[model samples]
Target: MRLLLVEDDTRLAEFLAQGLAEAGFVVDTVAEAGDAEAALDTVPYDLLILDLGLPDGDGMDLLARLRARGEMLPILVLTARGALADRVSGLNRGADDYVLKPCATEELVARAKALLRRPGGALGAVLILGNLRFDTLAMECAMENRPLDLSRRELAVLETLLRRAGRVVPKRVLEEKVYGFDDSVASNSIEVHISRLRRKLEAEGATVRVHTLRGIGYMLSEEK
Candidate 1:
């Protein structure tokens, strides 16, 4: 899943970013509310982990602005303010969940899972296409109950496609979601990943196909 982490503390931000990435999430982190707000304007994230104590502005303002714009994106408030009043205020301001600072990584992950399982969030870790099943939590893909070995990037691409199954996901979106903003993506890099993923799925006897929509993008659908 893709997530935006808005925290100003450089040490905590780096630690969380690395930890979240290792936990099978693509995280883009910014140190200030302004950059976070700008990122929200462009990127489509599955969830937002926001810190109320931002350097430039209060994270609550950003959350309120997002809600005012009618964006129902799932947001989790992660901050040091653990008082009952602070938690109540955060939820009242549109946060889906609130986690106190110095929280366990596992607890944070659990909360994220709970939020994503909500009605409108992305599908749970398991993605199904015909007889094929890809489990994001396990980082494994199975075809008809037989496990198919896949590399990390291959799994990432397939996960992206399967999450938005039947919808055309543009190459740029895939690049951003998979590699994040820091990596230098080549012109045909996405194509390479897509091609590799296609071969793996075909070899595994998956009944779904990844279709390229020419100049538009790619989609995953059951093979006819």
Candidate 2:
């Protein structure tokens, strides 16, 4: 999943970014509300981890503005204020959930994943395609009843394709999904991963296939 983390605390932001990255999320962080707004203008993040205390403006105002603009993206508020009033206000301002500062890493990750499981977010809790079953929480895939071994990039490629199964997913979208904005990608990097994923699934006897449309993109579809 791709996410924009808006936090002013450098240490906390770094910690959460690392943890989220390890948990298979592409995260771009901004310390100010202006930068956050600009980032949103470009990248379509799956969720937002926003801090109420910003260097420029109150995060609450930004949250309210986003909601007012009909942005229904899942937003998890990270704040030092643990008061009931703060929590209530955050939710009232369209925040999906709240985690107090100094909260457990596991709890934060769990909350984010829970929000992503909501409708219109990322993948569901579990994804089932043909005889292949994937557990989003576990980040594991199974073919029939056997485990399907795959590298991280391969899994990312497959995940992107599965989300748009039976439809074309452009190469740029796939690249952005699999790689962070700062990460340098080689020419045909996504194609290489897709090729590897295709071989692995075929060798595992998966009932689905990834097809490339000439001069366009790729699609995931059931095998004929």
Best by lDDT: 2
lDDT of 2: 0.88
Cα misplacement distance, residue 46 of candidate 2 (Å): 1.0
lDDT of 1 by residue, 152-194 (tens): 6677788888888999999887887787766677899989988
For model 1 the TM-score comes to 0.92
Candidate 1, superposed: residue stretches over 4 Å from native = none
Task: Count backbone overlaps in model 2.
Answer: 0
True-structure lDDT of candidate 1:
0.86
> What is the Cα root-mean-square deviation between model 2 and the actual structure?
1.3
Model 2 residue 38 CA deviation in Å: 1.0
Model 1, backbone clash pairs (residues 3+ apart or across chains), number: 0
State the RMSD for candidate 1.
1.8
Query: What TM-score against the true fold does each predicted structure earn?
Result: 0.92, 0.95
Taken over the whole model, the C-alpha lDDT of each candidate is: 0.86, 0.88
Best by TM-score: 2
**Model 2 segments more than 4 A misplaced:** none
